[model samples]
Target: MKLLRLVLPGLTMIAVTYGLARFSFGLLLPDIKESLGMSEAVSGIISSLFYFAYCVMIVLSTVITTREGPRRMILLAGASAFLGLLVMAVTPNVWVLAVGVFLAGASTGLASPPYGAAISLWMSRAEQGKGNTWINSGTSFGIALSGAGAILLSPYWRVTYGIYAVLALLALLWNFRVIPRAEKRWKVTFEKGNLSLKGIKGANSLITASLILGISTAAFWTFSRSFIEIAGDYRSWELSGFWVVIGIFGVLGGFSGSLIEKYGLAFAYKLGSLSIASASILISIAPEKWLVSFASAGLFGGAYIFLTGVLLVWGIRVFIKNASLGIGIPFLLLAVGQVIGSSLAGLFIGAWGYAPAFILYGFIGIAAVFIGPKKNKAED
Candidate 1:
């Protein structure tokens, strides 16, 4: 029961950080671009800036959380998010929105590492996969809600931002009330570790996997709405439906803790890599609307989250001494890939069209299979 209590709060934190702070961009992108009078390429660049800040802050966040404890970090994260939303709601210019998103991304970055670490500390090694999945599931749920809600509340972006700000504020209060503070000496222990070069090989492999994953994932995420708009000849409703479908499958992906547990991380990673490649190809070639959209969403959503879960667990297991750094390294690389993909998406779409870009992303996914870590006796 106590464990369940802990899990709920952690999950809530993930939902707020990921769903509201991060994933909401997908839902609100069209509105934001229209309202700000920005081109698609510029909009993508703005969104990429958020990820850029997020990537830089990951390591710093890990250090702070390790030293100060997750409770304090959560509070700080919530505060930053609230401030960012406030800026977005009221700011008069695109540059200001970029600054707001950067702050918001950094704030959310602080929550993830400590939250993952804290959850790991609370759960036994045998149950880590399930525990992490439950927390991540919150993100899926939040994405579903935010996407659907934003569409339903369209033409009211400012109001939506206000509501999201309120959510973050509430999360801050909850964190203060529910999470316990750490001892003063936790900082000392957190700082005592000596950096080593031993994890470089594993980190490199993880970074490669992350980059491929990001390219594949970003292509879908950044372009899904546009794709639907063009292919389905539909509006916000279809895009919302797609997100809802993805979230449903995303929940299933989260519950796939057993798959990771039984088959091991390598198997899960390979499955995700293959699924992403296959899905991208199918989405690229399919002429039928329902088949293309639903299949694309379900397959990509499931595979992406599954791979994320697998890689995160694998990082913690393989680099136990510096698990936070291990996780942060891959995430940073992933963010870079997202920025690159987003920046180029408009160019590719305008020049060659969606099918070609989708095909290219599919190849990237296929490459991930080869870049992934091979089975080794030592790895085992």
Candidate 2:
């Protein structure tokens, strides 16, 4: 029961940081672009800036959470998210919007590492993996909430964001009350920096795979809703429903820890990555087919979260000495690849078209499955 209590706040934290702060940008991109008088390429650049900030903060989070011990930084994550969304809600121009994007992006990075440390400190070995992954599934929860909001709010994007900001503020309060404060030394001392990741087996394979997966998923997150809206000529409610299906099904990914215990971790990773790639192809080619498009969203949402869970476990195994380092390294690299992918994908789409870009990214996701660890590995 106590363990369950700890997990809830972490879950809410992820929901706010990833779902509201980061992913909502994609969901609301059409409204935002129209209101700001921005082009797709510019939207892509802003999205890339979000990932760039994410990559940077996730790296810094590794060090800060190590020294600060999660609580303060977790507060920072929530605060940044709330303030970021508030700014985005009120922003009158593109430049101010970018500032909000960067801060909101950073919130996800800040939210991630602390929760792992918190769970590690609170949960038993039997509970740790499940708790962590369930919290990770909060991304889906946030998505669901945002989707519901979009449906109800309709054409009011700014009003939608303002509500999201209130959600973040509530999340902040809940987490502040729940997560324990750091010890005296935890506040003052810096984590001892080794500046080395020597002798970690399969490190290369893990990072390579993360970067590959990141690049592949970038286009989907950045443009899926807008693409669907354009390609299928979907109504606002239809798009909202599509987003909700993804979120509802994505909740299943929380069980990935159990899946790993039943099947091998490597098998789970391959299956999830493959499913994600297939999702892009399925929807991209058949946008006019309502059933196929919805199914694709559902598949991609579940697979994306499941794959991320796999990466979280994989990272911790490779860097067992520090939970923050483990989570940060894989996620940070993934964001780096996203920064690259997000920066360029709009150009590709503009030059060719959306379907071709999705097909291209889907193939890249397929390629990710083969970048497996070189050695025969035991299940973690």
Candidate 3:
């Protein structure tokens, strides 16, 4: 019970930070754009700024996580996120809002690596899958909560931002109180060279898979609510309900970490990726059907995040010496793909409609299967 208490707070902090930092932007984007008199393209770019900063901060986050350890990094991240959210709450213009988003992204970037590192450190090897899942589920929960909160408090996005700010502050406090600082210290080493394409070896497959996953997942996440709105059959709360259902299933999926241990990361990844591809197709073709969208959300949320946990574990195992750096590389690639996908989504939806856009995303997932590593049966 005592151990569970210590771990639960850390997991909650990660979930809250990720939920607000990444998923909330999509949930709140439509309202924010409308209030600011911006077009969908401009809105997409503004939201993409978060990912831009996130990608840039991955290197810094990796360094910090390696140096100071996960606990302190998380505290700093929470503080940064709090300030960023406050800035967004007070901003009067779109440009200012973009700056706020950038800061928020940087805060999350700082928080995520350390949080992931901390989970890896604290959880038993057998429990790592479930631990990571719980941490990741915070993002999904945040998304659902923010969406529901926005609908309940319509036309007052500032209030939602204020709520996020307060949550971040609480996370910061809890982290400092509960998470013990790392005692081990090691000399931080960087290769006497620039961060180039060549610095990363045998990481191509990971990066490629991450990019595909990012593009497809971001497309679904950013537009899922909007898709429901445009389909003209569901209430706003109903759309939010779908996300809430996804969040519930997400928690169930995340707690199945032990299952991944038995099945192997590669097998789990393949299954999750295939599930996402199928779910995307169903949701796209049957946009007006509530059950289809609801089922799709559950499957996609569960499978995508479950796969992420698997991949992170695999990366850590593959690059034990530079585990954080290895993890950051794939995240960086994921961020780049998300930015590209989100930026293009509005144009694609306008030109080709949601079905085609979803089809494109599904194809990206299918492409990932080929790019992933293929070792012999003996290697497994």
Candidate 4:
């Protein structure tokens, strides 16, 4: 019961911020483009705004949450989501839509770090990893919900976004009721010379791997549905179903902490990286085939969330002193990678097309495997 209060709202907040607010842009891009007369290149540039906003807010949230406690930051995140979704619902032009995307993306950045801190503050140490991963999986739930909305509201994207805004508001209200006021503020002092590279293990590998994975996954998150719709000439239901499959399979990622507890982070990291990379290559092979596309979506969803879960644990362990920083660092770098990858993906798809672009990203993921955490003998 104690854990339920935090985890439930935690998950929902993440779902609203990440799934609906951030990734859903890709799922709905084709329609949005048709409505706004936007090109793929322009769409990609706008999508990059999501990450840029996220990057700024996450850094600020990490610092603020550390000093002020999680309550205000969490509420701020919810508020951002609500406003962003509302803006998106009414957006008439590309500029207004970009503002909405920026705000929505900012919500995700505000959402993540504080939750990490909240888990550290509220849950027992033993329960922190499980709680964090469960909350992280909320992205899958939000994605699935958005996919369902797409099915029911096909070609009525404005209505779909309006409904999502109401949902975000509801989530915000729920969190406001549940989240407690600030307790003890965490103290972080760089001037004390307490933080150093030698003290934090795995920081380098974690940041590098996260950035690479971010770049590798950006093509999919930003353009996979478009690929399927255009390349496969999939119907509305089929495309929506593909997005749903990704979310449903992504729930499997919630178990990543357990996987690490049993098989260790090294194993989880390697397996997840390979699986996600394979997903990109797999879809490229036969996106026109429904089975292949859905399978690839499932694989990507599961693997992407799973890898993030692994990173959450890895980041927490690396920055054991500051849990918010633990969550902030890897995620911040991931957004940085997305910022770069989103832009490059647009150009690549424009120049070389989807297949070659996706294949190239897959190779990037493969390269990430070499830079992963060293296998711990004790955990192995």
Which candidate leads in lDDT? 4
Q: Order candidates by lDDT, high to low.
A: 4, 2, 1, 3
Candidate 2: tens digits of C-alpha lDDT, residues 1-380: 27679888888989999888887777687788888899967976887777778878887888887766778888999999999999999999999999999999999988888777676655665776788789999999998888887778746889988999999999999998888766523222324343358877778888899999999998887778778878886777898889888888889899888887777678888888899999999988788778988999999999988888888877766765566777888888888777677657888999999999999999999999998543246434
Higher-scoring candidate on TM-score, 2 or 3:
2
Output the number of the TM-score-best candidate: 4
Worst 10 residues of 1 by lDDT: 184-193
Candidate 2 global Cα RMSD: 3.1
Candidate 4, residues 61-103: lDDT per residue as tens digits? Answer: 9888877778898999999999998998899899999999999
lDDT of each: 0.71, 0.83, 0.70, 0.87
lDDT for model 1 comes to 0.71
Give all candidate RMSDs, comma-separated: 2.9, 3.1, 3.6, 3.0
Give the poorly placed runs of model 3, Cα more than 4 Å off. Answer: 1-6, 39-42, 120-123, 184-202, 373-380
What ranges in model 4 sit over 4 Å off?
36-42, 184-199, 377-380
lDDT winner, 1 or 4: 4
Question: Considering summed lDDT, which 10 consecutive residues are worst modelled in model 4?
Answer: 186-195
Off by over 4 Å in 1: 39-42, 184-201, 376-380
